[model samples]
Structure formats: structure tokens, C-alpha cells
Target: MSNKTNYSYVGMAFIILVFGIIFVPRIVDRIKNQDITRNDRMSQGQDNNFKDNSKLIFLEINGEAKKVPDFSFTDQNGKTITNKDYLGKVYVVEFFFTTCPSICPKMNKNLVDIQDAFKGNTEFGVASFSINPAHDTTEVLKEYESQHGITNPNWHLLTGKKEDIYKLSNEGFNLYTAQDDEVEGGFEHSGNFALIDKNGFIRSRVLNGNPVIYYNGIISEAEKTDEDGQEEQISMLKEDIKKLLNE
Candidate 1:
């Protein structure tokens, strides 16, 4: 072979050696760690595409997964609903009163959006426990449901004994709730929403390996940021709900 041809061959071999030293380990590591996802399902030997649920986690307490507590309340339709009713279905929970004048309206509006986004899916549902059951009776909740355009059959505006509701909110879900004669609405409750999995376990997407625990229910999806500079989480909640449903 000509000396020029021999030089070209040496150049190609050196380039390959450099690539093996610099890139080959990284490529193998990426494949091993699944940093590189392939669209070829046949090679993976999977019947269906699997969702990346690595970021999703259970809300744990004392090293064990925290599950939803038991409770039974009457829905707007006058039918009884309980934690058991949510089994085999994913749901969202919130503490609200129909007459809330502060953040509850915005919260439910966002929830209504979530309901609409996942419309026609029986496996998805919403649980709204009224903080003021005395005023937010089944009849009142029925009206609020109509006002907010909540058409989901599984979305329940529940009301029951005052103590039970408060206990469920403060003690069970840890979403704050209390009666205040000083507040604008004469009541106070958390403006966050909790996402639950199909098996009645509280679930959320993690941030830096820590569970988010709850989603902001007060922000609107249309708003880039609220007055406090908080971005809306309704979009995140919808995406996470889809992940849990597929799980």
C-alpha cells in the first residue's frame, strides 16, 4: 500500500482508540443506568411502553408508606362515600367549604379543571371534604357543584359531622383546617391538594428525591405566577395523576 494510504489507516485507528477511551464507557454507563431511553420496544421485550415512575414516591412516615386513613361521609347525592370507595381508583383530596370566600373558590376551580382534563375516565375521581359541614350540607354542595361545573360522576362534595371533617383534615391528611371568627370566610383551611393512588396510598412526585407531599390548589393554570411569585401546579398534578393511573 502507498505510504499516504498507510497514514490514513493509522489516523482512523487512532480516532477509534480515542473514542473508545473517551466515549465508550459513558455510552455503556448511560445504557446501564437507563439515562438513554430507546423507542425500540421489541428489543426491551416489553408488551407495553413503561412509564418512568422513578420520580414518583409514596409519602412515607417512620420508614413505612403512609396510606389514607379511613372515613365515611355523605356525598352531595346523599350517598355514603369512604376511603374504601376510592380503592381501585386514583383520586384527589381537598378540604373546602362551599361558602369559602378566600382561597377555596380558586382551589375548586383548579380541581374542576383537573376533573375536565381527565373526563370520561372512571378510574379517576376527586374527594372534597367540606370544612364547614354545618353550612355546607348535601343540598348546598349540590348547588356549589353546579356553579363550578363539576360534572364528574366520581367527584364528591362531602359533608358530615364537624369534628369528623376537621379530624380528617388536620389529623389525617395534615392539611390544616380550623374555624376562625376572624378570617374573611369565618373558616380556614389549607389551599393544597393531595394526590392519592389506586390502592388508597398518598403519592406524589419527588423533588431531589423528596416527596412533594401535596400540590398547590390555589393557583390557576393560566397564571404564569401568582402575586407571591408561585407558579401553578395544576399542570404538574394532571401529569402525575396520569402516571399513577398507568401504575
Candidate 2:
């Protein structure tokens, strides 16, 4: 047509382009936020299902269930214990040192109680891995085990090179237990009990301490034993172990 008509058409196209530029990201953002809200609701629902139904959500970290990393260590009795030894048994593994002035006692006590509870149940076992291997030799571990009245053959107190133990805790078990030379000897360890199923996959982590007290002074006492939320956590751990063993 004419120049005037062409300019009018170009102006209309420019207005439409500007409107799209201003609103597109906002629309996209609204859509993204809606998806996130949906996901959050689903997660909460799944958590509720666990609490109400007493079922768990197990994550298969290593393809077909996570396998406990293989490593060899000397037990309190100076006997070598390896991943092969626990092939057909369900086991709970924790990291601690004998003389830890912090959480070790409580964690060990809980472990002791677990060992005692499942005593003579050949299908299940417990292992306490020493974090301070330089000081916690096999002899020291043996003495510590005896002092605690831990006598189950299936239960093991293991000690190896300090580096090896640290690596196992950090990498193999996915529990970040490290030696803090600045933090007075013991170890800066997170109280966690990794439950490995019969097939050697880490199924769940039982928080192994009291929020108020890093250590429970006794393993059984640390368990969820009261009406408090603490008792529920402890009881759930027990139930989970039972379920895993039965599997």
C-alpha cells in the first residue's frame, strides 16, 4: 500500500514483541513455581505415609541397592573380619573410639544394647569401627569390648590403620567421620548407624545420638523408649532393623 500503512503495521508488531518480552519470563516462572509446589506436596505426603503406615522409602544408591564397601580389618580378638564374612547376615555399622569423651560411649552403649537384643540371632550382627586406630589397636578394642560386657560372636569391634578407617567412614559408608587434630584427639564424628541389608546395601541411617546429649551412655537407653519423639525414632530404628533382617 503506502508508506503510512507500512509504518502502522510495523508499530503494531513492535508492541506485540515488547509485551511478550515482559510477560514470558513471569509466566514461565509461575509455571515453574507451580511444579515445585506440586513436588513439595508429594514429598510431604510420602513422609506422612511413612509416619502413618510405618513404611519406609528406601533409596537404591548403588544401582541394585548400595553395597557396604569392602574392606578388611582386625577385630578385637585380632581376627580378620572382611565383607565376605557378613555375606548372608544383616549388620549395623558405627564409627567411634573407645575413649571418646563425647558421643562414643552413648553410641557404643546403644550398639551394645543392639548386640544384646539380637544376641544368638546368627542372622544378624553389629560392628563398631574404631575411629582412632592409632591408639585403638586390636588389644585396646578387645579390652574395651570386655569392659562393656560385649561377648556376642557375631558382634565385632574393628580397628585398622587410622587412614584406612577414616577412608572407610567417609567414602565406603558415606558417613563423614574425620579426625580433627585441633578438636582434642577423639574424633569429630557424626553419630550415625548405617543399616546394611543381607545383600549389603545401606538401607537407612539411624541417627545414633540424643539431641541433648551427644552420647546416651547406653545404647538401649538412647533408643526411642519414651513418649517423647526421641523414643519414636529409636523404636523405628529397631523396627527397621527387624524388617531388614527378615528381608
Candidate 3:
């Protein structure tokens, strides 16, 4: 009986060693190649398919999808640019001034972060229209861009007629912008970023089955919310931007 028990132990050890020798290396190789899956996330092939089926909605007006109006402006490099220039790019539009010392800083900081996320993608761009164009001339905007570490070649710090800027803000985009002496900043504008698709139509994520319209740019996603209890939507904006890019 003792001899039989010893033989059984030896057989079990041999079987275990054989299994390790035959399969352990292949298991390790699969892990090294990241070929293992835990049944939680989508597979690599489904990622693009997921983006294509996103629930992003376009802002509609008068039973038609609203499109960004035409406007011409000069960029920080003193080059002529128009809405047509952004036809094939997924872009974010914002109204701001170089001299703004309040929310504009926070808004642009978030935008710079977004630019960093898609560093090499020419399909992405930003249109920063200066509400204080008279003061935010090409030189001033160029200086501001440098000061803020703006490095994206596609980002256009635009300045044109102040009225045209205001018209685009108030009527075209419906994002408020005006000169207000009562405000901390001499000029007041929305601390919001408008996402546009490659076709120049405004795009947004659905909230309560309706378009969210604009993303709050004043708060950082890190903080979640501000001192005044305003929650940040920059994170959602980034996701929706990716969705639009995919579309």
C-alpha cells in the first residue's frame, strides 16, 4: 500500500510538470500580447463600430439641421479664414478675448488640454473668435497664443469686425457675448464651447432626449464642479468631439 501511494504522488507531479511545460509559456505569451479578455469591455474590433452607433444628436431649427453661418476672419498668423475653411474638420467654436482674465482662461485651458489629446490629428481644429477684436489684434492674439502654449497648427485665433463676431455669437451660435462694464471682465461671453462636425453642422450629446446645445468650458473635469456649484461638461465635450470625429 505504501509503494502504491508513492507511485501515485510521482504520477501526479509528472502530470503537473507536463501541463506547465506544454501550456504555461503560451499563456504567458498571450498575456504579453494582450490577447486575453475578461468579459467586461468591448473587443478591439467593436470600438469603431461603437462610435458609429453613438447617440449624438444634431441641433435642429425649423425642421432642418442647423448649420454654422458663413463668416470671414483673420487668424493669429494674419491669414484669411472663413467658415468654409473648417468644412472637413471637426472643430470647437468659442467666443473669447485675449485680455479676459476670468472664465476665458479656464475655458482655453480646457481647450488646450483637448488639443493635447488629439495632437497629430488634422481632422480636429479650434476656432477662437475674439470678442474684443479691436484690442485682440493679430499681434496680441499671437502673443496670447504663445503665452498660453498654444501649439496646434489648425487652431485659429480669429479676429475680425467686432459686430460680425457678436452677430456670430448671438445669432449664429446663440452663445451670448457683449461688452459689459458691470462684469469683472470688460467683455462678457459664454464660457461654453460649441462642437461642430465635419459637415459644419453643430453636434451635441443628448440630454433628456434633447441636444445639450453647448459644453460648459469654465470648469475643469478634474474639479467636477466650481465654487458656485456649476458642474463641468468638458469631459463630456471631449467624448462628444471624438464621436463627431468618428462620424
- TM-score, cand. 2: 0.68
Task: Report the C-alpha lDDT of model 3 over 102-186, residue by residue, as the tens digit.
Answer: 8888889999999998899999999999999889999999999999979998899999998999999888877778898887878
Q: Scored by Cα lDDT, where does model 2 land?
A: 0.63
As for lDDT, the candidate ahead, 1 or 2, is 1
lDDT scores of the candidates, listed in order: 0.78, 0.63, 0.77
Compose the digit string of candidate 1's lDDT tens values, residues 80-100. Answer: 999999999999999988878
Q: lDDT (0-100) at residue 25 of candidate 3? A: 42
Best by TM-score: 1
Tens digits of per-residue lDDT, candidate 2, 1-247, equal 9999999999999999887555543433332234322112211111111132233333343223446888899998889999888878888788888878866777776777677777788888877888888888988988998898887787889988888888887767555577777886546776656677777766642121101101222224444342333232334456667787777
Model 3: lDDT of residue 236: 77
Model 1 spans > 4 angstroms off: 1-55
